[model samples]
Target: MKFPKVQLALVQMRDAGSKTASIAAATTWIERAAAEGAQVICLQELFATCYPCQAEDHTMFDLAESIPGPTTDALAELARRLEVVIVCPMFEKRAAGVYHNTVAVLDADGTIAGIYRKMHIPDDPLYYEKFYFTPGDAGQPRASVGPDKPNGFNVISTRYAKLGVGICWDQWYPEAARLFALAGADILLYPTAIGWIDEEKEEFGAGQLDAWMTSMRAHAIANGIFVGAPNRVGIEGRVEFWGNSFIVSPRGEVIAKANSADDAIVTAECSLEEMDVVRTHWPFLRDRRVDAYGDLTRRFID
Candidate 1:
């Protein structure tokens, strides 16, 4: 195996009031994670800001910055110095009226390897993403993975491993997971910020968290790949960010997990060799009928 075993880590943190403070806190976490022997690290979605899409307020655009702006510059220098690959998700200000929920992969050498825009925008009660982010449509018809493929589902080759990264809402889609895995991603990473709203906690909290975990684990099992989720914790506005950060093996077993409400770093040693073993045994990819799934692209069959 090219990579025998890679140490993956996730920084699960809460909003530190301001974006600058959050970036500073994230920097501390990245250094700490690297000191703990992490080769690849992923921070929760929008690590440099509070979950700003809670409302469609026009002022939220002030939080957005270009990719090479302060956040990525700081992270890139840190990545080069620490020699660790860091997945940094940010609110991207692409143009005057254009923005995206994007993840910039900083390679070990500090280069921006690639970026994946969040595709599946959810317009739930507090999770108002559609108003803030344009659905990712900046690439050509895809047959493989690259920066030029579908702007959403991309497998970025890093120094430690090829990372298939998806944002919060994208985590629930099995199709996205399959495409990432097929594109030769070694481990799938989903940086998220999800929790129960103050109103929905009583009736829908536990089930919601359960489904969040189940869906990601199923992706690992179905695709014969490792999966990692790093979620935020503590209360932010009306929502309490449940920090159930975790890592799962190819067999869908939780190897490492954090509590629902703790500032923690969830770390796991993933074996690239195990990916080969599991894929050979399960062979789900070998049996896929790719020729018959064309209808998947349609919005409705009827």
Candidate 2:
């Protein structure tokens, strides 16, 4: 089936200290993207505020807000006015003590379409996410299973296509991408805020960025689907986010790429027709031996 060509805009921005600055910067970028004929737009992870996971200070919890809070309300209105789908990532305070790294998908009509929480939480030097967010229960393929429930990925259908939303750490796992593809996702969207630490920038920065981009591209090629990664740029606290945001086509070719340290809107035209063509020629999904992969359920087979 020949699908309509969809234009996507990825907004890569510097970490703005306050929500006011962040919203203003995002609004400006969204207007620019609309003028360029973008139907779907995505912002970087934790775009509303600076990367708060840099430290485990309890005061950082003040940044968290309800899903339908002011940020989403404003973005929804913007989506309606522009007639575009907006993926807004925010620090979500789910309940009294529960919090999450969540992305809210606002439809063209300005309605809240769906929300996907970041299933994978990374606990590294500058990234102390485990101190703030509770790991999402979205049931990715690698999720630990309980005796009563089975784990599977979540694929949300939009007007344009079926979207599988994954945050930064989730993008590193091929299993996450493959499970989403198996669940019939046409595209995988990753909202990220990744960067180099103070000292590691000189030693491991280049390799880290390369691995990040290459992994996502490999996911696109392996799944025969489009992959979109919108990452933030600029220095925030001790970490400097490397802003190499890009969109990879079904054939694993980068159609659009942003700079490594700039606040720019990267647009890409995705052709869904290529998905059918590519998957037909390379039938990896068809040859999968599901019965032989039971070992995947274990953390590590010794």
Candidate 3:
């Protein structure tokens, strides 16, 4: 398979205190990236509002909005004008009491290409995602939504790339990464909002950041796919969001990365063709022991 070099862009910025302000800030960064030849752009997780799951407050749910809401509508228009593919991750109000951490993939023409609800929900201190989001289900892959297929995962196909979309916590799971790659996605994008809690920063900060990067990079190397992580920067409440947003190659090389302290538009040119060459040489996919992996479906082998 042949593909042209695509400019991948990550808008790494601080929470703008409000959704309107954040969107405006992101739009500026995106415009700058597009002017510099970015074809596909991504924002950090829940870019429209502040990271609200820090506490279990019921008011936080107010941040969740339905699809085609204000945020998506604005981004869709921007995407159409910019003629770029925009990966907009949001706090989705799926229904009255149901919500999700989802990414709406908007095509260059402003139409929604597809959406991938985040599959992994975490419930750790200062990061209580499970309280607000329902675990995403990729019901009956490739099947249309119906009684047979409750809520199937749709393949996000855009003009510049086929996206394997995941949210913050989802980035830590290898199964999700492999499934995305197997689904024929060329790049794995994790729109993130991970950071260090004030107390743990001095003790486990360095190792924490390294482990985060290594996990995603390992996913890229194992699946022979490109990976882009756009994490938020600056401080919010008790957590300091160490940005360091990055783009890694199929070979696990950090091709482009942002700083840990400021807002920036990090861009990298992905040689999509390199995936085929790398996969052919590595042959990990071709050598998978599918018949011997039935145990993987279980929670554990007790």
Candidate of highest lDDT: 1
Model 2 residue pairs with clashes:
none
Clashes within 3 Å, all models in order: 0, 0, 0
RMSD of 3: 2.2
TM-score of candidate 2 against the unseen true structure: 0.94
Q: Per-residue CA lDDT of candidate 2, range 168-252, in tens? A: 9999999999988998888899999999998998999899999999999999999999999999999988888999999999989
Better of 2 and 3 by TM-score: 3
Give lDDT tens digits, candidate 3, residues 29-59. 9899999999999999998889998999999
Q: Whose TM-score is higher: candidate 1's or candidate 2's?
A: 1
Rate residue 14 of model 3 by lDDT. 93
By descending lDDT, how would the candidates be arranged? 1, 3, 2
Candidate 3 runs further than 4 Å off? 1-3, 145-154
lDDT of 3 at 152: 31
Model 1 lDDT at residue 16: 92
Instruction: Give me the displacement of residue 64 in model 3, in angstroms.
Output: 1.2
Give one digit per residue, the lDDT tens place, for model 1 in 1-302: 26789999999999999988998999999999999999999999998888987888999999999978899999999999999999999999888999998899999999988888888899999899999998775465555545434355768998889999999999999999998999899999999989999988999999999999999999999999999999999898899998999999999999999998778899999999999899999999999998999999999999
